[model samples]
Target: MTSRFERGVTYAILALFTVTSLTPVLGILSTAFGRQSSLDTGFSLPDGLNWGNFADAWSRAHFGTYLMNSVLVTAAVVTATCVLAVLAAYAFAVMRFPGSTVLFYLFLAGLTLPQEALIVPLYFDLRHWGLTDTYWALILPQTAQSLAFAVFWMRAYFRGSPRAVIEAARIDGASSWTTLWRILVPMGRPAISTMVVIVFMWTWNEFLLALVMVSDEAHRTVPLGLAFFQGQHSSDTVLLAAASVLIALPVVIVYVLLQRRFIEGMLSGATKE
Candidate 1:
């Protein structure tokens, strides 16, 4: 009875925190649909909801093009990060090789390195290859930046996996790649889901890299595009708010769909502790 009361109290506290955190987001959401007159209005649902604001923002900002570019770049980044990290992590966790620990630590080292430190070198490196202002510039750098986190996540999941299962696969003459593809990755769905959510969030919110790497307006990502929109529509608060809602929609949708997996992955990771 006492334990149940404690659990209920903890849940109440958490609920309060969740609502507090969501207050700002809710405010933006409210403003996005509200009338221009409502900006000065008190905090409540708009007296008149304006659906035209979204349509106007979309048509005026060339958001369709921006959305396409973001989709392409984000898809490439997510796919590359997942595949490379899973392979590298399986190698480190399951394979017996020389300097394995050293190599893993090297990958771990990347997690601590700031993007600002590498931006200058990356700029020159991309420019030398004549890749600047291209999708490759954005896709390549973001993929690389996200790889360290993916590898670390997959490695931890793999480390916690059962040794007997891997040994049995090896006993059956499964090659390293075969074991990773057939056994490990299939079982690492929780980790993969977590990685997907994290990578998507990072890629979606990435502004500095997109702003720096993508010079052409056509190639601008959503965040960078938002900045562009703000510049172009500085006085049009209604349009800006509507664009903000559209920009934030994809992430919300993805989260809604995969939230179960994400929560399971996160909780399971903590479960091991």
Candidate 2:
């Protein structure tokens, strides 16, 4: 039913988008496996593939340690953010309190506040608390930073939930905590999953806080490690690309796994009708 012109335009747009999205990824992959002599040239498919780059990157960067640290930090952050966000969101959404709206707005203000703006104060605060150079420094502050957005997101989802179910649960003698854990949480899984993915991505990619907080080599996250790799040697392009791919692997995997739930949550949140 489509006209030729319309079909051509559609194809053009599709190709543009495909190229835009895949260009960097493909470039990275190609460089990761391509020969070292081609470093200065713009990305293209290599004539011969080299698997040695991955092995060299793995050993040179101590990416195994970095990966472990990243996983640990990410896991801790997601778990803490979910628990705190869910509880705070449930309170804000379901409970009645004086100045609750004002307080919630105060939390919402955190979304507008840039991390760069708070870096100086946060540095001193962490040092004062003797949390610097430790996992707690990174974990605690990151949790605090992520809480505002998490609460806002979760509260929106909770607010959109059916009130009748909550009322019925209350009438059935379900306690507040019981209702939240048993009823609201189960229903809000999609939203929670979306938040989890987003938070994981942000935390995984976070660099500044990780740089400021952890002085030790062993505690450096993937981003910091990648930055180090990029700066280590100008000629090490293949290894650099391999490291980049490894850095992005977890995010790609997680997104592929939960993309359905993420889309459902986003649609549910954005559409009122």
Candidate 3:
């Protein structure tokens, strides 16, 4: 029982927020193609699109190397996070053991600890172990952070899974791992895919971890690489815009491809069959 006025107000609010979000994106798009002589912050209707900015930015910023590094780190982190989260979440959601609840909550606590609070201590610890300035530095910390949230998110879905189905799998002579892989995993594809996409985006966009951990130019992630590029190319607005887009494109492409699965996963958790 909704009234027209309330519905209209809701639509109006949504539209307002949508435009607010798109405004900055459009501004970046405009600035990416804008001439070097221009100084405006927003998009100009009259300014022609300049495609060369992307090529210029790529060559100038050494984005190819940085992009590859980001891909490697993101892939490793996402893979590790997904694997670890699935196993950890499954145990928390289905298995009963002494101290399991306490251990699970400990993992959840990681979600509350901001990177800023942890980065300084993390740096010294990694340095003591000689892990800093290496790809392992970037991959390991990001995976741990992503795992904390991934386990929390995925445990909800796994907990909602049918106990009857789990019992059936066990009765059929399936071991715990077999039941997980053959039954639970297949049933949880939507949730797993969603986890993968989200972890990929977070790991790719991660900056502070990369910045403090990786002092070497060769080990830098895309966000850290983009920061350095922005530092030197601060005067070239168009190039900076182009670099931003380049750094962001892979994530955009991934989301676009998996958007359908993501939506289904979100809705899956809401509706039980």
Candidate 4:
């Protein structure tokens, strides 16, 4: 029932957005490849593809260490958030227990509290426990920050799942654990994949928490490392662009790998039955 004109309009809008987004990325790439002496900035083609800039940035900035730290922290935060969110969401969506509503609402309350409001107290508590300057300092706080949204996301998916299917699982004498892992979890792949992608990006890009929690250079995440790198190489646009690309590459790769599932999940509304 859609008219051709509307479809054309939609495609035109999408194309415009695509170009707008890609322009900055293309500009960075151009600058990243430019000669060290060249002063060209945004959107200008490089004199040549100077691949050495990447090598220089990687070595001089010690991006390898920072990248590894980010990987560890992001992986831990995503895994913990997803696993805990799934369990908590399942319980909230399916299980009836005392104070379930109150408990779920409390979890939801976490979504309302900004990280800035909690970071100071959180840093003190972690320091008191001797967790500062460690992976736990990054992983624990990001995991907690991500949990509220994760729980909310998964709970909607679980709650909207067909009641008849759940009843059939129960009729087959399947335990709740078995039903969740063997049945619902498999069916929820798209939703879970979406959550994984989102949490991974958030944790990978987190700066303030990393800055406030960890002071050791060994524990600096990519964003924090990039900030310091920027300070030192403020005038070296080529090197700076290269470092920015390095920091952003993993996120791009992850999204590309999961693009199909991500699109499916987005299109299939979170609360769709």
lDDT of 3: 0.87
Model 4 agreement with the true structure over 1-273: per-residue lDDT tens digits: 889999999999999999998999999999999998888988888878899999999999999999999998888899999899999999999999999999999999999999999999999999999999999998888888899999999999999899898999999999999989999999989999899999999999899999898788999988999999999999999999999999999999999999888888878865557
Q: Which candidate number has the best lDDT?
A: 4
Per-residue lDDT of 1-273 in model 2, one digit per residue for the tens? 999999999999999999999988888888888877665434877768788878888888989999999999999999999999999988999999899999899989989999999988998998998888888878888888899999999999888888888899999999999999998898887899899999999999999999888888989988998888788855677778888888999999999999998888888882122
Judge candidate 2 at residue 122 and give its lDDT: 92
Best by TM-score: 4
Score every model by TM-score.
Answer: 0.93, 0.93, 0.94, 0.97
Candidate 3: stretches off by over 4 Å: 1-4, 268-273
CA lDDT for candidate 4: 0.92
Candidate 1 local lDDT, 1-273, one digit each (tens): 469889999999999999999887877767777776544422568767789879988998888999998889889999999999988988888777999999888888989999999998899999999999999999999998898888888888888888888899999999888988898787877779888988998998899888788888878988898998899878766678789889989998888888888898998981122
Predictions in order: lDDT: 0.85, 0.88, 0.87, 0.92
Per-residue C-alpha lDDT of model 3 across residues 1-273, encoded as one tens digit per residue:
899999999999999999999999998888888876777757674278788888988898888899999999999999899889989998998899899999999998998998899999999999999999899898888888888889998898878888899899888889999988898888888888888888999999998888888888888887998899989978878788889999989989999988887888888872236
Residue 38 Cα positional deviation in candidate 3, in Å, after optimal superposition: 2.9
Residue 97 of model 4 has an lDDT of: 97
Rank list by TM-score: 4, 3, 1, 2
